[model samples]
Target: MTTHDLPRLRPEVVLGPALRTGPKTVHHIKDESTGCFYRVGPREHFIMGLMDGRHTLQDIGVQYRETYDRTLGPDSWQQMFTLLGRYQLLDGHADAGVLDRFRQAQQDKQAARQGWLRRRWVLLQPDRLCATLAARLGFAFRTGFVVPALALIALLQTIVWTHTTVLAHDASHQRSWAVAVPLLLVLGWLITMLHELAHGVTCRHFGGSVTEIGLSWRFPLLTPYCRTDDIVLFHRRRARVGTAFAGVFVGLLSLAPVTLWWWLTRDGGPGHRIAAALLLFGSAGSLMSLLPFLRSDGYVMLTHALGLVDLRRESYRFWRLRLRRRDPAARDTLRAYPSGDVRAYTLYGIATLAVAVPAYCALMWVWFARLRHWTGPGWAVVVLAAETLVVAGLLLGAARGRRADRQAADA
Candidate 1:
C-alpha cells in the first residue's frame, strides 16, 4: 500500500501498557489470534495507535513529523508495513505466502516438543477459578488493604530475623528427621502452590487472564507453575508490577501466622518447633525468590518496573558485543540501540555477573563442605571435581544452544 492508503490494525490485536525507561517508552502489542507478542518503540506505537481504518499513511506521516520532528521515508513505510503484515497485525486478509510461513512456524513449534526435559503436564485450566477468586477477593488488591498487609509482613520478618538463632536451634534440635523432612516437603510444596495461585488471582484482579496451571520438572525438582501470560497485555505498569510481586508478597504473608506461633509458644514445644521449621525454611525460600539473577518474581518485577523487554538476553548480548569492541560490526550494532538502553544493558550485565558469580561460588563451597562432612575430604574433593566438570559441560552446551538461536534468528 502507498502512503495515501489507510492502514488498520486487526481487531484481535491488543495494545499493552506504556513502559517508560529513561527517555524511552516501550509498548507491547499482542496478537490474540496467534498468541504472539511484540515490543515497539514510541514512534511505532504512535503510528499503530492511529491505525483504526481511518488514518491514511500520509496523514500518519504528517502527524509523526509534527510530533517527533522526523520524516518517514518510503523505505521506513515499507519496513513498517512488512512488519505489520509479517506479524499478522493488519486487519485485512494476509497474503498466502505470509499464511504459509505462519503455519510452518506453528508446525515447527508443535513438532519440536519431543524432549522429556521440555515436557509439561497441565494439571487444570484455572482461568475461571482465578476469575471467581479475583472477583470475590478483589478488595485485597486495593491499596488500603495491601499497604497494611505489607507493613505487617515487614514487621513479622523483622521479628523472625531478631529471633533467628533461637528458631534455628529449635528447628535443628528436632530428633524426628523422617517425619520433619516429609512435613517440610509437603509444607514447601503447598506454599509453592499458593505462590503460583497468588500470581494467577492477582493477574485476574488486574484485568488479565490465567489460562493454565501446570507441573514442570526441572532436573532435581518438580514444581507447580501458573500461566499469567496476559499480564503482558495490562495497560498499567502498576498492574503489571503488582502481578509480578503478588506471589512473593503472598508467600511471605502466608508465613506470618507461623512466625507468630513460633514467637508466642514455649520454645521447645512441638508447635513451636514445627512453626520454627516452617517459618525458617519458608521465609528463606520466599526471600530467595527475590534474587534478581534468577527468572523469578524479582526478575519479572524488575523488568516491568524498568519497562524493558528480554532484559537478561539483551544484557548478555550487549556484554558479549562489548567484549569484542575491536570489531567494527559489534561496535556499530551497540550504537544502533538508544543510549539509555545501552547504559541499562551495561549496568544490568555488570550487576548480574557481580551477584551471580559470587552466589554460584558460595553454593559450590557449601556443597563441598556438606560432602566433606558426610564422605570425608578426599571423596568430597573428588565429587566436587566431578560436579565442576558436569557444570562446565552444561555451560558449554548452553553457549552452543545460544549460538544456534542467534544463527537461526539471523537466518
Candidate 2:
C-alpha cells in the first residue's frame, strides 16, 4: 500500500500520559522538580527516555537494545537521554518513581500508531515523489506537453507567485525588486513589476513619487517587491484603490499583445495557436493573481476596495466567534472597514470560489481518470459538485459573517 494509505496518528494524543497532557487535546507539560516544560514534538520523546534518572549512559544503551532492538551507535540512546536530562526534563540520579505511570502510558500510546507514522512519514517528501514521476514519465515526453501546456502553466505559476510576492506584499510596503532600473524593469514582468508600475503611474497622476523597488526572500521563496508604504500613511482612498489594483491593471495590459496576435492570425496555424495559448496562459495567470484567499492583487483590491486590512483575519475571527456564540461586529470593525463597498469583496470571493473549486476538482478528477488514458469526460460530476460547493460555501460564509457583525453591533 502507498504510504498515504497508512492511518494517521492523532497529533493530539501522540504524547499520552508521559505527555503530561490529555487525549485528543493540546496541553502543557512540565517536570515538577526540574520545572522544565516540554512544548514541542520530538523533545517529548527525548524527555521520556530520561525518566529513569538512575539509568547510566550504559544502562540507557542496554534499554534501547531491549526495547527498540537497536545498538546505541552514533547519536546513541545514551546521548539522547543525556540531552534530555540537560533540557531539564530529568534531574541526574533524581527520583524515578513519579515517572513510572507516565512511562507506561507513553508505551501504550506508542503502540497505537507506530507502523502508520513510519509509512506516512516516508510519503511526505514531495521532491522524492516528483523525482519518481520524472523517472517513470521520462523528461522527453513531459516536454512534449510543454509546447501547448507549459506556457499556460508558466503564466499561472508566475501570476500566482508574483501576486503573492509583488503586488500583495512588496507594493503594500512601497518597495521594488531592486535598485537597478533595468533589473527592476525585467522584474516587472516576472515579479509584478508592471503591476507596481501601473500603481506608480496612477500615484504620479495624483502627485506622488515612485519610491523604491527591490527583492526580498519571504521564506521558502524569493520575490521582487515595490514599496508603497508611504501612501497608506496619507489614508487616501483613491490612492489605496489605485495601488491595490495596479497589478491587475498591468495584467490586463498584458492581454493586449495576445489578444492582438490572436485577432490578427485568426486563420493562421501553429504560430497563431501558440500565441493564443500564451494569451490564455497569461490571462489565467493574471486571474489567479487576483485570487483573494492567497493574498494576490485580487486580494489587495478587495482589501482596499473594501477598506479592510485583515479581511481574511476577520473571516477567520467571524468563523471562530460563531463557534463561541459571540458577536463578530467588533472584531470585523477592529480592522479597517469599507463604507458600503461590500460588493467588491463579495464579487472577489465569488469569482475566486467559482474558479478555484471547479478548477481544483477538475484537475484532480482529470489526474485520477487519466491514469490509464488521455481523453474523455472524466470525474465530471465530482468537479461540478466541488465547484458549486466552493462557490456556495464562500458566498454563505461571507454573508453570514457580515450578518453576524451587523447583529452584534445592533445588540
Candidate 3:
C-alpha cells in the first residue's frame, strides 16, 4: 500500500490482443489460472508492466512519468493495486481473503470449461476440421479470386431474384403459420453457421486468428457465432470490412443456388423444400445482421473500418445532442471524434433508421396477424401495447446511453 512496497504480477497472467475501446486503446488480459479475459486500458498496462517486483511503487511511478510524461497518480496506484490483487495478478503475498476469492474464481472457470468440454468440445472437432480445411484452401479467399467468385455468385443470385420475385404469393407458402416459422428459424441457424464460417475463413486469410467458431445464444434465441476479434489489427480497412461482411455475403451467395433450384423446379425434392424455406428465413437473418444498429458482422466491420469502437452508442449520443439537447460540451465531445467517424456515424444512423422503422413495423404486423386468429382482438391490442412498450424501452435506453456518454467524457 505504501510507495516503499514493491508489487509483482503473478506468473500465470498473460496479455492478448489490443483493440480500440471507444476512443481509448485496451488490451485483453487473460488470467491463465482462471481462463477468463479482462480488458484494461493503457494506464493499466503501464501499471501491470511495472509490477515486476524489481521496482518499488515510487520507483515505478518515477519510471512511468519519465516514459509517458505524466504522473501515475496516487489514486490510480491504489485502484490498480486493488484490481490486480483481486484478480490474483499480484504476487500471492496479499490478504488471505483476496487470495481465497481469486481461488474461487479459478475453480468456477474450471467448472465452466468442463461443461464446455461435455457440450461444445464434442462438436468442436468438426469445427476444427472445417477450420483446417479452410486454412488449407485459404488461397481461394484472396481478393483476386473472391472478386470473380462473387461475380459468378451474384449472377446466380440474380437468376433467383428475377425468377422468384413472387415467391411470397406461391401456393406452397400458403401453409400453416406454425409450420413455416419454426422451419425458417431452424434452417436459418444451420445455414448461418456457414456464414460465420466465412467470417472465420476471411479473417484467417487476412492474417487474423479465429478465436471462436461455435454456437452462441442471444437470450431466448440460439445461433452460431464466429469471432475474429484480432482482425482489428489489420492496417487495411478492406481486410476488416471483408472479414465483417464475409458472413452476410457468403450466406446470401451460398443460398443463391438453393433459391434458384427452389424457383426453377416448383415441385422439387425435400432438399428443395427445405432450401426454399431457408432462403426466406435466412434472407431476413442476413438483412437483420447487416443493420449497423446491433452487433452484427456489419456493425463490427464498419466500426473497425473507421478505427473506432462502440460507433452505435457514440452515434446515438451524437444524434441525441443534435436532435434533442443543446449542450455545448456534448457538441465539443462529438466534435472531438475524427471527421471520418463523424461522417460515417451520421450516414449509418440515417440508413439504419430508414430501414429499421419499416422492418420493425412489418415484423410486428406479421406477429399480430399470425397470432390474431387464436387470440382474437384482445390479442391484437396486447401485441400493439407490447410494441409500444418495447419502443418506450428503447427510447429510455438511448437517453441513459447519452447520459453515460457525457459522464465518460467528463471522467
Candidate 4:
C-alpha cells in the first residue's frame, strides 16, 4: 500500500490516546489532550471485559464463572471501568458516541493547522539548511573550523543530529523537507551535512547506492536517516558496519589532525597550549558523537550491529515483553522486523532511565539539601515537593496514557 493508504491513523492516534494490543494493531480513543497507550494484561483484561457491556463490571466478574470459566471473584469491574473512565476511556456512562465528533473535530483542527508543517517536513524533499553552506565552505574551511569550532559544533552536532536525523529520515522518502530544512539550519550547517554525508558516503563506499536522505520519527523523537534501504547491495558485514559507523567515524576523523597537533604541541609555550586545549575539547566533541543512548552516532552504530530495522521500536517492544510476562494469559503483540538486539535494547533503555532520572533527582536533592542546610527546612521542603510534583505529573501522564490506550484497544 502507498503510505497514505497504509492506515493513516485516525486523528485519535495523534490527539486521542492509543492502546496497542499487538505489533500492528492499535486501538485509539480520544483523551481530553494528547495520546496514550497500554500493554499491561490486567489493564487490558479490565478493558476488554468491560467493553462487552453485557453487565456491570461486578456482574461480569460474578458471571466471570459463566463467561471465561474463571472467577474474578469480586466487584473489580466497577472499579476497573471507573478508573478507565477517569482516564477518559469510558465517560461517566454516557452515550457511546457522545464525544466522538468532538474528538474528531479537535483532531481535524489540529491537522489543518499542524499539517502544513508536517507536510513540509514529512512529504516534500527539501534541501536541508546546511547543505548549501557546507558545500560552499568545502574542505579548506572545514579544516580550519575543525580546531576551534569542533566543540561548539559538537554541541551543535547533537542538536544537528536530532534535527537532521528526523529531517533526513523523512526526506529519504520524499517527506518532511520543511522540517528538515529548519532543523538543519537551527542545528548549524556543517555538522548536519557531515552527519548525512557520513551515511551517504559510507553506504556508497560499501557499494550501496544512497538513494535519498530525510527525516523520520522514532516514536517520541525525530531524526534524519539515509535510505540505504538497498543494504543488500553489499553482503559483507564490514560494509554494513562501516556504513553504520560512518557518521561518528567522520566526526572523529575530521578532528584527528587537530587532536594530534594538540598532543604533539601540549608543552609548546602559551599559544600552543591554548590551541592544544581547544583541539582537546574539539576532539572530545567528536567522542560525544559516539555515545549510543542519546541518539548520537553511537546509537545508530548499535542499530547496525544488532541488524534491527529500528532500534527504538524494538527496544520498546522488548520492554513490552517484560510487561507481558506479568500476565501470562494475555497475548504479547509486540512486533519488530529483523528483531536483533531486542534484549540489548531493552537493557539499554532500562539502564538509561535508571541512570538518567534518578541521577537527576538525586543531584537536585543533594544540591537543594545543601542549600537547605543554610536556608532552613522550609525552603528544602518546597523544592522537594515541587520536584516530586513534576515527576508525578510526568509519570501519571505516562501511566494514564498507557491505561487508556490499553482500554481502547481492548474495546
Which candidate tops TM-score? 1
The C-alpha lDDT values of all candidates are: 0.79, 0.46, 0.67, 0.49
lDDT of 4 by residue, 1-411 (tens): 232112122222212122222233233233323323332343344345344334454454555566556765336545654555544444234344545654565446434433211221333222342344335545523446545655655554454344444433333432245653464354333555566676665565443445456665533446665654334324454555566666655655554454444345544432333333333443455566676665566666665565444465556656767578666542343343223354566677887788679877788878787878987889887877887787677656655655564465456
Ranking by lDDT: 1, 3, 4, 2
Clashes of each: 0, 20, 0, 34
lDDT, residue 398, model 1: 57
Q: How close to the true structure is residue 222 of candidate 4, measured as C-alpha lDDT?
A: 62
**In candidate 4, what residue range of length 10 has the lowest lDDT sum?**
13-22
Q: Which candidate is the best by lDDT?
A: 1
lDDT (C-alpha) at residue 177 in model 4: 51
Better of 1 and 3 by lDDT: 1
Q: Which residue pairs in candidate 1 collide?
A: none
Q: How close to the true structure is residue 292 of candidate 2, measured as C-alpha lDDT?
A: 71
The residue-by-residue lDDT of candidate 3 on 245-287, one tens digit each, is 8888888777767676676667744455556656655666676
lDDT of 1 by residue, 1-411 (tens): 642387888887888867654334678787665555577887888889888888887889999999999998999988888878668788774565765676577547544552443346788788899899999998898889999999999998897788899889888977688888888888878888889999999999987778678886543356677888888788778888899899989999999878867767864656677788898888888888887765678888888777766678778777878899999998887777788788888888889889979987898899988999899989998998898898777666656665775566435
- lDDT per residue for candidate 2 within 289-343, as digits (tens), equals 6667655666666665555544554555433443554446545443343334343
